[model samples]
Target: MSIGKKLANKTETVRGAAKKYLGRATGNTRLRTEGRLEQAKGNTKQAGAKAKDIFKR
Candidate 1:
């Protein structure tokens, strides 16, 4: 994956984790679910980018 994309994914993952933690602490199911979804989306994108790079080689 490109450096920019990798960095972006990592940042998103971190943000998601923080959001999830805050949601749990505050007992907000919606925020918790959204955070989990964001993290999953970031992970999926990162995986796709890595696969593309591997195929390009």
Candidate 2:
């Protein structure tokens, strides 16, 4: 993956993790779920990028 894309994905994952922990600490179930979904989205995008890179080779 390109540098920008990799950085964006990593940022998303980190942001989601922060949100998840914050929500848990604050007792916000909705926020926690949103964070989990966001993390999953970031992971899925990263996986797709890796697949594309592999195919390009």
Candidate number with greatest TM-score:
2
Q: Please provide, for model 1 over 9-34, each residue's C-alpha lDDT reduced to its tens digit, 9 standing for 90 to 100.
A: 98888788888888999999999988
| Candidate 1 TM-score, C-alpha based | 0.86
lDDT of 2 at 52: 95
Could you give candidate 2's per-residue lDDT for residues 1-57 as a string of tens digits? 789999899789888888899899999999898889888888888999999999999
User: Distance from true position, residue 41, model 1, in Å?
Assistant: 0.6
The best candidate by lDDT is 2
C-alpha TM-score for every candidate: 0.86, 0.92
Clashing pairs in 2: none
lDDT of 2 at 57: 100
